[model samples]
Target: MDAFIGAYLGVLTLPNVSDLDGELLIHVGVGRTVGIWRARHPGDARALFLFRSELGYHHHGVPRQKELLRGAFAGMHAHAHRWVYELDRTPAFYFDSITQLRMDRTSLG
Candidate 1:
């Protein structure tokens, strides 16, 4: 897992991250394996959380926006999008929008 995180961060490091606010958050993990990681890192928050399982996965926070999540993952070769939104006590509506935008951007090469 250390290597995976390191590689993931290394990829992110090369990108131009001028903003790190309520933007999209992308995470890749194996099916239910993400839950385990999330359990260990409870402090982390995401607007959109995409979990990929052999059978399928779940999209929490926003139900109607599942299509957007699928579109975001369409091009990726990975299992799913593990998006984390930092609400910071903010409302759910606002955070959901922010998460979608971040997910959209992260999907682009």
Candidate 2:
């Protein structure tokens, strides 16, 4: 592997997350990206990327971030928007569930 991206939030559940080669991706700011693969597949669970901290505090203190995330996947399948209070503290990560996201410590500032 290139290097284990720290799971500051958690681990990746989706097997193909590391290889978004043929998927259509969307820039979600904060230097993060969301590859839309199974956005709204009827009964399938929707997936999106996140900055570990955003997933950790989605309901605690980031409403605007939540709104932006929701807006990003509004008609599709985004859960919420993630914003940071400390820009320098933000870490690169991907959301797999509501409680946590797949984190990469090496990608952090």
Candidate 3:
């Protein structure tokens, strides 16, 4: 964690970041990660599509848009859009972890 933080802050001397295969949870509203991502992928239609898809996924089939949006984006350590790659094929892969995490957090609190 410290190494990744140092690398993100540009205060660490490290090799290629490409070798790191793990995911990093980032807050979209704060810090430089969003800017860095945008800068690195200017005019990328794929990124735009991904953002729209995530937005649509979380709010789809819901009438209470306000509450749904609040639950999706607010009161979390990491506030960002979450995308599950497989919606129809293998939803359990994503929801299982999501359920466990929510349960763990609720229990912890």
Candidate 4:
């Protein structure tokens, strides 16, 4: 964790970002829809969240109008932290951790 943080802060001696992965907080409009997912490549072994956006009947993989952060879209950590602050201010909605969606593959057939 420290190594990744150092790299992000540009304080590391070497730009060694091994094992560092970026994730996303997908939102369509406001409370209408929300979900989380990790960026993936086709050559990757598999994915934790095989996310696909649903627009009435249309389904898509990636989000449009993205604001890049850390070589990818903004991560879940930043979004989650902001959500906490907003909750404290307005207390409008509820949030929960859905940890059941493990990002690692542990099953074998």
Candidate 5:
């Protein structure tokens, strides 16, 4: 995972990010990637990822990460976007829920 994250970080420039956003709907899975990044490179992940407050909604102290995960599924139905990247090894339930969002086995090269 560290190696993957390191390679991704190597190419994670602002212009590349913009191009990625233009092509696909991306969502960070509520998992160890952020924690690992924070531990490995403190203060850097904060700049790259968005927080709950940035989404312009008040959670009233409820855990917002859970809401964000739920919202990812909700947004799939509410919106017409066909692609979403759950930036982790996605689980089976995800595949069961959304049939169209298949895993792309093609290389990034």
Candidate 6:
């Protein structure tokens, strides 16, 4: 597995997080790759590869991320963008284009 993917998998294995309200949302940004992962089954966590866009590359803008993710999800669905691995069933992980990039280390074990 890729280094980032391995890191994400490791993060998912840590005990159950109570604040997710029955869902797990993960956001990752590495160079041109930025994505959010949702874990439907607590144990079904998996990494997803997302396409990056240079046209809109702002960081941490919740609204922009939401819009971009919504549009990306829609476009992906239309284009049959299916993940090879099982991920969260809910679609809550959104990418914003204009928000500050906070280093959330709480999720890292």
C-alpha TM-score for every candidate: 0.24, 0.25, 0.18, 0.18, 0.18, 0.30
How do the residues 1-109 of candidate 2 rate in per-residue lDDT, one tens digit apiece?
2323322221112323324444554545443444434323232222354433333333333445434444433343242222221122333323332433454565755
User: Which 10 consecutive positions of candidate 2 have the poorest summed lDDT?
Assistant: 79-88
Model 4 regions lying over 4 Å from their true place: 1-24, 27-76, 95-109
| Candidate number achieving the greatest TM-score relative to the actual structure | 6
Candidate 5: residue 46 Cα off by (Å): 8.8
RMSD (CA, angstroms), candidate 4:
17.7
TM-score of 2: 0.25
- lDDT, each prediction: 0.29, 0.35, 0.23, 0.25, 0.26, 0.35
Candidate 5 ranges with C-alpha deviation above 4 Å: 1-56, 73-109
Clashing pairs in 6: 38-88, 39-88, 40-88, 59-99, 60-99, 61-98, 61-99, 65-95, 65-96, 65-97
Per-residue accuracy of model 3 over 2-107 as CA lDDT, tens digit each: 1111111111112222222333333453222211122122321111111111222332332343233334434433322222111222212111001111232435
Clash pairs, model 2 backbone: 5-104, 6-103, 6-104, 6-105, 65-81, 66-81, 69-80, 69-81
Off by over 4 Å in 1: 1-36, 40-62, 81-95, 99-109
Worst 10 residues of 1 by lDDT: 6-15
The predicted structure with the larger lDDT, 5 or 6, is: 6
Off by over 4 Å in 6: 1-49, 78-109
Could you give candidate 6's per-residue lDDT for residues 1-109 as a string of tens digits? 1112211111111222223344434333442232234356663433333544555454455455434444444433321223311123434343333324456464856
TM-score of 3: 0.18
Which whole-number lDDT from 0 to 100 does residue 82 have in model 3?
A: 27
Question: In model 3, where is the ten-residue run with the lowest total lDDT?
Answer: 44-53
